[model samples]
Target chain A: MNSAASEPALIGLDWGTSSFRASLIGADGGVLDRLAAPEGIMHVEGGLFEAAFTRLLAPWAGHSDLPVLASGMITSRNGWVETPYVGLPAGGKELARAIATHQTTDGRTVHFITGLASETDGAPDVMRGEETQIVGAVAMDTSDGCFVMPGTHSKWVEVSEGRITRFATYMTGDVFAALRDHTILKALMQDAPFHDEGFRLGVASGLSAGSELLHRLFHVRSMPLFDKIPAGASADYLSGMLIGAEIAGGSAGKANRGPVTIIGRDDLADRYETALGIAGLTTRRAEPDIVARGHFTIAKAAGVIA
Target chain B: MNSAASEPALIGLDWGTSSFRASLIGADGGVLDRLAAPEGIMHVEGGLFEAAFTRLLAPWAGHSDLPVLASGMITSRNGWVETPYVGLPAGGKELARAIATHQTTDGRTVHFITGLASETDGAPDVMRGEETQIVGAVAMDTSDGCFVMPGTHSKWVEVSEGRITRFATYMTGDVFAALRDHTILKALMQDAPFHDEGFRLGVASGLSAGSELLHRLFHVRSMPLFDKIPAGASADYLSGMLIGAEIAGGSAGKANRGPVTIIGRDDLADRYETALGIAGLTTRRAEPDIVARGHFTIAKAAGVIA
Candidate 1:
């Protein structure tokens, strides 16, 4: 490797569905420089995933043959190399063993981390990039409980003894987007910054709404008619209700219930924390860069770099 | 009025979002003939509702000065005339009292039967067309209990002493369509006939899915991965889950524990009946043409005809 063996230990990359994020990690597991590109797994066309990624990483051409640790949708079926999801009770070690390796034309050794496949008897559940975040979060705090990572497909992971035992996936953001963009509720909501009181009320309503999520959602439109819920607050309220329902259902049978460790951006993580709080659950937030931290942890375990 | 003063008794119309259905009702409450046109409320454009409806009814020009009774979206804000929703505990007589009369230049007195508005303390819930169906269903069965009308916006209505007591609305069909057309699960589904066993299992799963509908729904994608639910069966299972959740939420705290009277088409009614049966509830379907039957009963209550 061109760089000193211990100088910059790894190049960590998190390529998700919509965006590609990378960070240069030093031997001390600290991020040196963060890089990003619009070339997410989905946006990269054809099978030119490696070429596209290489071009994006051309800025660091001098660091030859630097071992890279990649996670997220990059290891998915549509990604460069389809890495098999390791079944859970997975941890950093399980993820490290299943790392799929590839070489770019520029001779960079890229080690990709596979995700966790939930051991569900009924439905086959899986998560690609979130497992890395789990490792990163667990590494930071050795406590075991449920961890929530909210996004388009928010994940509720069960962590026990530093291992991801089981989990559930909720399409909270996807359903909300579909309803807003495609359904009539779109017309009912107004553009307004999220108000917490409205969100709390929404959580209350959603929980009381029972199992009939489809039925309760209609109230978003009707509440405005009687001026019960203002139009501007409707979006936040809807968000709260969906998130509330997700928490109620996801936490149904979990034996290890305590303060959930949330790993995400500020806005989404805060929303989930708020809802979880309202649902009588406590939560602690890991650092925002858990995905990168995860990559660093997995890469170290795989010996991709010293 | 023309046509022997009592021959065409009353002209009944069911104008909803997608289409306009009209029936010529004789004094004996029998439909002499049914006429349908694609000119639904959405199609009647440019503030020419009366004009468009007049052109469609030009075939019945002979019945000049005949009083017309209209229900459904044609009575909403976007319809020809915006009628108010009567509060719940409303029945045939209450609906008759709230009829908004209009003058269609075809020399006809159009008596529009307004819908019932649910008394939701948190949201202003209302249904324009389903109330007519409830009126008709109650007239036929006279057994006072809860009535469910499954459609684009499925409704659960309560009745007591032959009067509509209260109700709630679920966007079951709307959400189903949104997922089928807008969500990723659409790719995993196919155009297959409704499978009863699959639907039953779905209902069981949905009801038992507890509150985490947002999470359980993701299993629709994964179930096939584990060979738990087939690709074709996924659609039926998803449908069952949504419908089951609706029943669980809608039926909560209802005083009337008797068998629900479902007023809908055969397919939807049967699916609901199956789900309800699995939930340990009994159901009996009302006549298929509850909307038409409702309009007829309302027309008579309004004294627009004998």
Candidate 2:
């Protein structure tokens, strides 16, 4: 195992509901190679996760004793193992202690990272993959700050002293997508693009509509019919409102005096960054592979690969 | 024409997307008889609104010279004719001034009531059927107050001195239905009933999340999994949140020294009433046929029926 130190550093597996990607990282924390499959945990046929896992990684069976780290929905009750969520205030080193492991029939060891559960006073919240991203985030900046990860389920996380102190999730994307197709505004904007001007206006509207999203959404209908909102701007307006409302809603009570960190693919992160700017809040974009880095960082500190 | 007035006070027709209801009113503005059909403007095939209206009313061809007053989507671009919207601060008197007339083949003139347009400082807002309801509400009580009409597209209207001064639309029911059937929350709430306790909890969450509805919605997913929110309560909780958030967002920026008038069917109005109570606001329920009253009141004031 120690002899593989010069070989590929580690395998980072981000397995979610609809897809899974495996990143081969070098000892220098650089991604050397990667593989992704359409086999998300939801569509993992017949519950043959191990068989699927091995078949997916069959190409690298003989690549030394490289330890595999897994994250995302694959660790849930429906996935391979129901890894109990590690409660709030945990980072890479702390998360390392509660890692779940399994030995493959093909003579290899795989380590699955558990998700994080919040200790918030309102509701019990949890996240599986973002914890890794946040860890990957903390790996770069250990100082205290709030982090925004935009996606289907966008997470607003707070990190202080190397641990994920608290967080919240906003279903911004899903709600916007569904509403676009499901509501009346969908008809007028079926072919509308995300116009920059319209989007900015929507952000402003969303701030005004904050939490009153139901009432606010209809503006997409009235504004257009009123010609106040031009043609092809309804969709952008919807997007802006959702994102703006999300920022207002996600950061409502928090004492966010400083800038927040946003982590996601370039496109999604860019949209959030734009809206954050409109809301007069500053933001820094986290590296795209922050999750992979977190996997590498946390696994290393856990002594799983060393 | 005046002789026919004795036969029937007026015919108040509520024509909308999915259904059309024709109400026969007496000289006293009381509903004498009613007829409903599935031929809403949307389902009316072949654009034969005139033919359909004739065929549907053939059952009472010679009953009276009742000036049929049509409202709702039937006057939109897709309906028989696009009766232009009457601008805001319009009650029955102002609306009457903008009435459009259509001549039927039988030499009868149908009086089409135009929808109301808001002169609000922001975008142009319009409503067809709700305006009639508001007019009717005004007929009953000519005072300053906010009105909540809960439905697929809920209307938050303000009336002063018999005129619909301002109004806003909340797609609360539509959003909830779509989120239930189109989003991830739908998966968790396949059979979620409106649990009373869950509804209360959801209402509170909604008020908290109203400013951040997108952020707060995700709690439906995590709280259930964390065992903090019981199974099957997610849907109800979501309902409460949407309703509660609507109140907060809708009521924001408004000065309400008086109670609101909530109009709708029993179930939705009841839920809204309960939520309004929880939100520390007072609500008075309007009759189910309030729309008819509005139409009749406006038509009488305008001398459409005498």
Candidate 3:
């Protein structure tokens, strides 16, 4: 084992449903190197996560003594192992304690971080690794602001001072899938990724005529009936309807007085920015690998590294 | 056939998915008698509708000498026959022509009404028998306003003078079935129909939190993960989310500048009124049998009966 004086060693693992990435970082918070594996917690069956991880890191077998800190669905109920949920206003300590301690066949310290939870108007919402990203985002900023992390389940979190005040999760992913696959809106869309014109139109239609979104939604099916708008615009129309409604309702704009900073890919950020602009709000953008950065900040705060 | 001196004889049929009711009215507009049958268009094998109708209406077999008017699924593509759409601001004469004029197994005068089509913002919407209801509603008052005829596919129609201006259908019943049967919200509801409290709460939740409705919806599954919001409450919550969102979005609410009237059973009318109240509108009650009244109005308009 490396002494703290020599260079404390720690490994940070970002594991999710479909992929896994791990980094070996020095005590100074510098990455030595990283390894990626397609075999995520979601891909592996229960009870085999340990073996999968062992094979994944076999090349780095020499670092058997490093402390392992993991995040993502690897800790979900159906993941490698189920970790207990930590209640609202959760932080690093809560996450660390909720982590399940494990010993690999080669004898390594394995700790999976806990997910975050909060009640919105008495309804409960939870997030796993996103909490790490929030921690990093908060660490990067001195003032309080809302964080919008766009993904399958887009989360908008509020932070006051250093604590996670509250958060809400939108099934933007599910809606995307549903509209694209299950709804008649699918017919009106091109196979290509959403065009900006379509996206903009959708956002505009959603907001300007937002109150009628639901009623007008059926027209996506009825349009071809009366020989009017092309069916291909249905997908765009639906996207605009959902996102426009989100923006009009202030979901992606600001939080209690804090500005919004969206953390995602460039195109998505642009779309969101466009949506927010339409809803009359200015927003900032951040491109750091949020979960990895969040985990790094957590490891640093815990004094195990950095 | 016996006839009244001033009015022409007319037959009005309210054929629906599950049942059929035909009223034979006199030239002076009195119901000569009613005929009921189980052979809803839904039960028939499409082309067999003519044969099925002939078998059921053997008594009025001679009515072939009179003008017979029909409403309902009989005009849908899969019903008796598909009638070409009549453009908006128009009525059902072409629809009458489109009807399969069967020289029945025995001859009969059969006239089917055509569905109405209107376009808004480039999207087209259509309504079938509801045009008859709008015709009926207008007969009561020729001034411009909105008229809502609620059912499985609830139609909110706008009319001015004698023309149907615009219309939209809300899948209110479909949503009700989906929420009550397939989702976690069902856990929160009882099989038996409950009263006004939950219904009113559902409407209010939909109105204020309508934008977050989808976000709140995902929690119907996650609620049991942390706190104990009854499964039944989830049902109520979902119902509220949909109906409430509709109220906020004005699904059945009309854009016309006149009083709103709801037509349905007492319980349903109360729910709509409550939803309308939440939307900041007042409503008057109309007879639930708008179809029958619609039949009478169309007959009068066509001079088939006065």
lDDT (Cα atoms) of all candidates against the true structure: 0.80, 0.82, 0.66
Candidate DockQ scores, in order: 0.75, 0.75, 0.32
CAPRI quality band, candidate 3: acceptable
The residue-by-residue lDDT of candidate 2 on A1-306, one tens digit each, is: 022344488999999989989888878676777889999999989999988898888777766378899999999989988888888778887789999888877777889899988755477777888899888877866657888888888888988888888888878889988898887767877575568898888888787675667877888888888787787888988889888888886776554568888888788788888988888888887766777788889889889766
Residue-level lDDT of model 3, residues B61-131, one tens digit each, is: 67746667787767887777677778767543333334444345556656677677777766677777777
TM-score for all models, in order of appearance:
0.93, 0.94, 0.76
Task: Give the candidate number with the greatest TM-score.
Answer: 2
Candidate 1's C-alpha runs over 4 A off are A1-6, A104-107, A252-257, B1-6, B193-197, B252-256
The top-ranked prediction according to DockQ is 2
A-chain TM-score of every model: 0.93, 0.93, 0.85
In model 1, chain B matches the true chain B with a TM-score of 0.92
Q: Residue B61 lDDT in model 2?
A: 72
lDDT of 1 at A102: 87
Candidate 3, lDDT over the whole model: 0.66
List per-candidate RMSD values in Å.
3.4, 3.2, 5.7
Q: For chain B alone, what TM-score does every candidate structure achieve against the true structure?
A: 0.92, 0.93, 0.82
Worst 10 residues of 3 chain B by lDDT: B91-100
Can you give the lDDT of residue B5 in candidate 2?
38
